[model samples]
Target: MGFPKHLTSAIIRLELPKNDGGLILTKNLYLSCDPYMRSRMSRSTEGSYVDSFTPGSPISGNGVSRVLDSSLPGFKKGDLIWGVINWEEYSLIKDTSSLIKIQHIDVPLSYYTGILGMPGVTAYVGFYEICSPKKGDTVFVSAASGAVGQLVGQFAKLYGCYVVGSAGSKEKVDLLKNKFGFDEAFNYKEEQDLNAALKRYFPNGIDIYFENVGGKMLDEVLRNMRHHGRIAACGMITQYNLDQPEGIQNLFLIVAKRIRMEGFLVFDYCHLYPKFLEMILPLIHEGKITYVEDIVEGLENAPAALIGLYSGKNVGKQVVAIAHE
Candidate 1:
């Protein structure tokens, strides 16, 4: 694939392979623009779990694709799929395991880039395994309007927990409350005192904290946690872009409050994907769950879509639709 010289433009030229392994995917759906990718674009001595994208190479991400050709077994032409792929018109996936066959087509294909994919799994595993929520528990989600946070709030509500979320904008705050059915939502940008804000919403204190944005937010939430509270440490979007990440001041509260905080990556719980689908798909079909997506049209917009996440420009799950199937 050929990219623009300046590395700032959206236009890309696809170079057809000399030989096909019989596995070719024409980008037919959307790609997720997540906050985590921001770190990957930078060159740092501290290596990331995933390799950074090399300049002039087509950027890759989690996206929904449709098979255009197949030499591999089980994958035939016209199969709708979603997985990691390059930021171009088409991608050749050699390892078919990365590409999961889409079994359910009743819902929109874009959903796989978010609510039904990595973000969904992150929320499920973080909440169920790390948070260990009980019915009637009060849950707080930071960066609540994001891909993972939105699902976390909904999952908590489905579990009979009182859920509150914190976002960066009024629109996102409204989305958390009105669309996602969060018990209450607040715009952290408008709140002068975060710790006080947490106290206001969760007077009894938060039983579970689905931490997505860290830094000051985590510090505040820690002070407001109920005794024996569980904190599911998901992604820390707040600290991702910083040259120097902020340190939490109130960590001592963890010991004082007997809080149980644990961090997890979705890969650790991949085995539970089947179980997650069984639980969430029904809720989706029955209308018990709602998903919100902020789709940027075409692969050209992928850069801005990813940058929008940090600035809170995205209203919900940030996705880049490469092509419509």
Candidate 2:
């Protein structure tokens, strides 16, 4: 166990460890910087599903890596895999539970950290399953240009839904409407009243809300939901770093409008990964779906890359490039 403290970038040199038969040694290729990781930085993760990071130790998150040597069964040298791996250059993995061997390389390998991996699965399960989206429904997404939110907007658009999204900047707002094919997008920071902004984009009222950000935004979305609308609570990036989470004043609207808001964790739905890939891989190949990544080179810059996510410094999926395969 390690004490919790504010995040700071540091590098420590260590000699290569002798890999025992049970361990799989890997050279990390890419690491994902996601908003959910902030919760792990806290000293006590009381309500968080994931465990807190041990301070002064190598923190781990979703990463793409290639196996160099493996003595573990079901894994061998030269296998490309993605899952939870250490932030360091070389990791001797003892836990194989989260590891998934990559079967497709036709797409960019760095995508495993974003659209093709956890974020992909997250967007799939949240929109299709939790939201029960119907064609022609009006949809709104928060943090719209991010890893998971981008995919959710595209998915809703493909499903024939009228899609709108909210991002933090003009650049991201442009990307959502121009690049991601969103019906409309707004820079939330520029909006004095989010409720009015949402109403302007969704005059018919939102039928589905892909919630990546919470706090004041959620309070407004609740007020804008139509009867029997669905809300998929994928993440609440705004509240992760706060000493106390904000309250939603319009939660009563959920009952008044007969809305259904469900929170989900992607890990619990991993069984659907095969189904998700079957649907998404074709979309990627046909250019029906597009993914953007903000790649930061080297392990030393990983901390800043992760920190950038909270401040909306990243334009898309933030990835730290550690090594080339």
54-89: candidate 1 lDDT, tens digit per residue: 877777778898887666778878889887877777
What residue pairs clash in candidate 1, if any at all? 22-71
Error of 1 at 5 (Å): 10
Task: Output the number of the TM-score-best candidate.
Answer: 2
| Number of clashing pairs per prediction, in order | 1, 0
**Distance (Å) between predicted and true CA of 173, model 1?**
1.4
Clashing pairs in 2: none
What are the models' TM-scores? 0.93, 0.94
Alpha-carbon RMSD, each predicted model: 3.0, 2.6
User: 176-240 in candidate 2: lDDT tens per residue?
Assistant: 98999999999999999998999899888989999998999999999889999999999999987
Model 2 spans with C-alpha error above 4 angstroms: 1-19
List candidate 1 stretches off by more than 4 Å. 1-22, 45-47
